[model samples]
Target: MTGIDFALNHMAAPRLGLADFFALARSLGVSAVEIRNDIAGTAIADGTPPGDVERMADRAGLAIASINALALFDDWTAERAAQAGALIDYAAACGAGGIVLCPRNDAASAAASGDERAAALREALAALKPMLERAGIAGFVEPLGFAGCALRSKRAAVEAIRDVDGAKAFALVHDTFHHHLAGEGELFPEMTGLVHVSGVVDASIGADGLRDAHRVLVDAGDVLDTVGQVRALGAGGYRGPVSFEPFAPEVHRSPDIQAALRDSMAFISGGVARPAA
Candidate 1:
């Protein structure tokens, strides 16, 4: 197997400032990063202008790969449209490569008719395509594997993109944790724009019970098979950044985030040479 390329997601160290976050990414030998607008008191949350973020990343010699996400994207309300426009503007101004679009996840969202959900998805993509193209950014659609998520299948996202003529403006986010939870074996490398990697090591929890809180850095105990998943994506022709997105509070609270990250990188990279049996 070839070497795995890695990128850093700000969720790993939400407490850091913009400059510090970029520096941490550089220190970890990761040249690309994904920042978030959701964390309170942070750069985006604190009203740091888009140009400032671009300048900060430039000074640090880092690439602002993508904005962490635009949530409830599948719902596609007027409010969501407004929010998407604003985020796309910021992404263009900040020189970020793209925007992550997360599907609506709730019991109500899951209960909607399949046809209704498909129609909404098509409408949203058709509406979002021009904005993304004008801004020169790709929309990275992430399908959550949880039962309550409105969009749970990459195949479904691809089909919707085709229906809306969004093949060029949108791509899929093949998230390892979600893939495991979804029990999906397919890897759509051609349509994948990014890959999110995380691990769940709790031996007692079943896939149905898994939640974002269970996500932690990949390690020896990882039950989600992060190594094999990454290898498969790479072998299947994916060459994008494998960004870390550990939602577990413990990872954020780590006293030495850099060290912990280094360890995970080593573990993941080592797996390339010893492909899982």
Candidate 2:
């Protein structure tokens, strides 16, 4: 079955309290949740604890799909590693399956490209392997597929994971948005760890535009051809949770987040039920 994980993007719903979000998730038939660390009221809501974020998830009876990501690993100074380690520890406490590591558009974008930068990312993750192992969480590497974006494909991300010797500690989040932006034709369905789905109104509103903000519902669009994507997942033998990561301002504007998410689930199941095998 295709499960849609609702994202708590602060920009989308500034007023939606975390408890309200839990109710919304239950109403929307979502058993899984992926919280954005950047959002208000979240654990580490502001580089600090938001208090009982994990307890809240427990109360909601939800499984943490994943953390959107911990950005900027290229500047792997000892101090920075300590800071990143804190986030990892929090993710473990929150019962998150993994933490997404986005190498592109990171705070350390200035150092996100070139072999040195890539190697630094590898080094950083390697340095954190012990801590991550102790925490028992996987590091999910997500590639941002855009021209100006530093990291735009799973290939480099895969290499980074390999270099970190993180086969056990790391996995991949294959976002369809990034997949299209990267113009990626290569398939590593077997390599796919987690998959994110969202649609854009205009193709031009792609990598350069509002980005995750433009993530609309999977209504009518080329991206909604998720059946092929799901088939690809099956072919790749990916059994991970597929998240409905819509970052649109309009979605949050909806008086009811539940209905919108249920619609998304229907679209996914409808699309994926088609045979591609």
Candidate 3:
């Protein structure tokens, strides 16, 4: 079997600046990294020039995997179009391959009828398709599995992408945490463009109760079965980046983040290499 191609998301080390973040990724021998707009004082949020980000990644010999996300993407509005355009422009300028599209995850969106949600999803994707194609970038649609998430299944995202004939410019982000929360069975490796891997080790919280604060680096105690998900994706024909995206405050505050990351990497690598039972 092919070895896992590991990538790092800024969320894994959000405290680091762009240059330092790129350096950290390189230090871990990680070639690709995801940059996020949500992080305060970061390039995207601080209005740093895309050229500067590109130069830093180039100096560090790292690839910008994808801009972390365009939130509430299914609720396309005039403002959303502007935001998408700007993000796409920046991603192209930074030489990034794709931009992540996060669907609406709120009570109202969740309350929508299934048919209504599906139609809205298709509408937004159809509108974004040409824009992404024009920029020569892929839209990585991430389905959040929270109870309030409007898009909770990769199967639904795939269907929407197909309905809009967006396969050429769109793909799915198979987030292990979200997958576990959604209780989804299909991997859809063929439609997957990226994979976000994180683990929940807290034994007290039920799957429904798990939150981003509970996310931490994958370890032997991980309840999310991240290693199994990775192995399944690989065996099913995914040869894409598997990115570390722990969101726990503890992980972000680790004094020795590099060491912690290395340990998680080793643990995941070892697990992925083991023969499946």
Please identify which of the two predictions, 1 or 3, would achieve the higher lDDT against the true structure: 3
Q: Please report, in order, the local distance difference test score of every candidate based on alpha carbons.
A: 0.92, 0.68, 0.94
lDDT of 2 by residue, 180-263 (tens): 777776657667767787777675554455366777767656553555666577666777767766777887688876676677
- Model 2 clash pairs are 189-236
RMSD of each candidate? 1.0, 3.2, 0.7
Q: Of models 2 and 3, which has the larger lDDT?
A: 3
Give me the candidate number with maximum lDDT: 3
**Candidate 2: count of backbone clashes, pairs at least 3 residues apart or interchain:** 1
For model 3, how does the per-residue alpha-carbon lDDT over 1-277 read when each residue is reduced to its tens digit?
3678899999999999988999899999988999999999988899999999999999999999999999999998999999999999999999999999999989889789999899889989999999999999999999999988999999999998988889999999999999999999999999999999999998889988999999999998999999999999998999999999999999999999999999999998899889888
Candidate 1, residue 131: lDDT: 94
Deviation from native of the Cα of residue 274 in model 3, angstroms: 0.7
RMSD versus native structure for model 3:
0.7
Taking all chains together, the TM-score of candidate 2 against the true structure is 0.85
- Candidates in order, TM-scores: namely 0.98, 0.85, 0.99
Query: In model 2, which range of ten residues has the least summed lDDT?
Result: 3-12
Instruction: Give candidate 3's error at residue 221 in angstroms.
Output: 0.6
Task: Give lDDT tens digits, candidate 1, residues 18-93.
Answer: 7889999999998899999998988887899999999999998888889988999878889999999999999999
